[model samples]
Target: MAGFRPRVPAPADITMIAHHSVTLLFDLSDGADLAHDARGRYGRGSVAVGLLPGDFRASGRAGEVLQIRLEPVAAAALLGAPADLSGEAVPLEDVWGRDAAQAEDRLRAAGTWGERFTAARDILTRRLTELTRPDTRPPVDQEVAHAWRRTLGSRGRVRVGSLADEVGWSRKRLSARFSSQLGIAPKRAARLVRFDHAAHLLAAGRTAAGVATESGYVDQPHLHRDVKEFTGLTPAAVATAPWLAIDDLAWPASPPPAPMHQRP
Candidate 1:
């Protein structure tokens, strides 16, 4: 997928930050009145990127893009807040990193990975005391997100019983709490995490069969069905769908990650 032609903005140009992890993107694009169609909001352009968690759909009109990726745990630690995110895009300064203006200026000048990461680390160190609230409030479980993350990394599978056991909560309690906090059920969230992994593998050029086996799906067909359910496209279709494909390449494939436990 090299030599990807820079595309004109289609109606749904926004894509999700997949991979079942949190990430940071530095928006270097000019101030185009961009809308996060997923959240249904618009904002002025700036040198800030969001420290976002998994599957938070985002899109905007075309602009010069500058961004840095971060781990979910690292990102959540910096934000020090929880809940499903659906909010007005905020300046990078308000969250983790150095002074928003200074960082933006540095990125504009230095234009190097080192410079961008330095700014990212600065933000991670300086916690956001107030910008802790998600743009939208959905019942989501911090514990489940954390457990789901571990399950993915360890076994590439999510078992509800195991998650509840690890978090020291009953299955019913965990499901209820997860629903209340993330606005999704524990099982559903786990499915998204798995599906997210599948999406990543596909984007990375792993064949559907290999992804299915490695990601712990029963088979390729099962994986295909699940992917279609989570995202309306088949595995092959997702490969070219504007929203998902753009998302697949939105950031460096192997960006830094944060641990889930560090969030609370």
Candidate 2:
């Protein structure tokens, strides 16, 4: 959970790399409509941005927004079907229906960031509690959920085959089940997670060659291809990407006005 109020003049375009989290962005300032984002076309004052299969470009001020990032496994349950979430963003109203308006109202009425955080937490907790009722969305399969955590825990280095073996299922069955439950195939999920870790390594001053080896790429060129495919940028360019520049400070135990990036 974090809050971001852009102080710098918002760029007309920003590059958002694929991440494994589902991002919920609530606009407090009634900013301009978002265009060409993960959702292709999206705007509703607030949105839940999902894990784009690859990097994407977004246009909006990101002005005064509260950000809540959820694990994709948990996201599968909270944000409607994982399939609908991937490759696009969804309006909060789409999932919450009419109650989304009420949540926005409470969020908007908060007096301080503290108040805002409380309001947001309350909303999320309430929704999660509702899912615990007799029937909501079906719970994510335990094996599939375990596979996701294993993928993330290894920084995407774990082999998909091994994951399948561990779960005592054939790769074909595992792939199908994982994709259905998680909104993406296991290999692609690993690639996205790997790319995410490598990008951070680059941003933290590691050489591409080093990152490649450390991140489990076949070689520098392999790393090059994956990075380019994910971000459409060279490893060097990604090293200084504006989105990754202040990452060290972006996530604090208690945040202080960071940028509201929908997985950017």
Candidate 3:
């Protein structure tokens, strides 16, 4: 398989792991630092390639990045840890759990693609070893995630407050924990989830109006504002994206020019 490789300091530091698919990465070799900011409406802030909504912005590595194909939602679900690519060295515990230090060490020690790949796989496997087989009862956050998924499927919208209430957490407490673990706010996460739903509909050749309604936008104008704000482009621009092919190896792009809609 044609997997990507990570590097420490080189232009090729950030390489595409798969064709617009799940990204796998090899960290910096030895003591070299990796730097990059993953900024977008759909991706995690900064995290390992397997993390969902994670798009590689810029990184410094001399090694290789090994990657695989993964759907957006599946990628999001695998995010049981925290990731930060804000050009700041966020503590691992602040992002992941108490085990974050160990994971970071292992990742940093990984020098080659083989080493990093093995470490990543092992870390993920061991971390989620409890869920090797599905169970009726899961951790509270996981339960909350499930609930959010259900809400999205039914009403096509999710509010952080509702989820926090269900889990008996204050909004502040829940947001703090969620941001540390997921590298984004609960409300932003919900917005991305909603955007994902709309993206899928649009990709299926659905009209903007239809997609807006189905994905819970208040109206076409509202959808237009959302599409523009999330993506730097308009819906029409995205609709004609030339790289809109399956396995097309394209990053989601900004939309076309349109009048700015003020955020209420």
The candidate, 2 or 3, that scores higher on lDDT is: 2
Which model, 1 or 3, shows the larger lDDT? 1
The per-model lDDT (C-alpha) reads 0.52, 0.74, 0.48
lDDT of 3 at 48: 44
TM-score of each: 0.61, 0.86, 0.51
User: Which candidate number would show the highest TM-score if scored against the true structure?
Assistant: 2
lDDT of 1: 0.52
Show where candidate 1 strays beyond 4 Å: 1-14, 17-19, 30-35, 46-63, 69-72, 84-106, 109-111, 128-146, 177-184, 204-210, 219-221, 240-264
* Ranking of candidates on lDDT, top first: 2, 1, 3
Which order, best to worst by TM-score? 2, 1, 3
Of 2 and 3, the candidate ahead on TM-score is 2
lDDT of 3 by residue, 1-264 (tens): 123332233444342211212343323334334454443322222234433333334445434323333333333444333233222222234434566556657766666546665776787667556443475333235644554455455443767777778778887887876665445566665666676567666766789999898888888887787667655567776565432322222323334212111110
Runs of candidate 2 exceeding 4 Å displacement: 8-13, 30-36, 39-44, 53-55, 134-137, 250-264
Model 3 misplaced stretches (Cα beyond 4 Å): 1-23, 26-80, 83-123, 126-156, 246-264
Looking at model 3, how many pairs of residues clash? 28
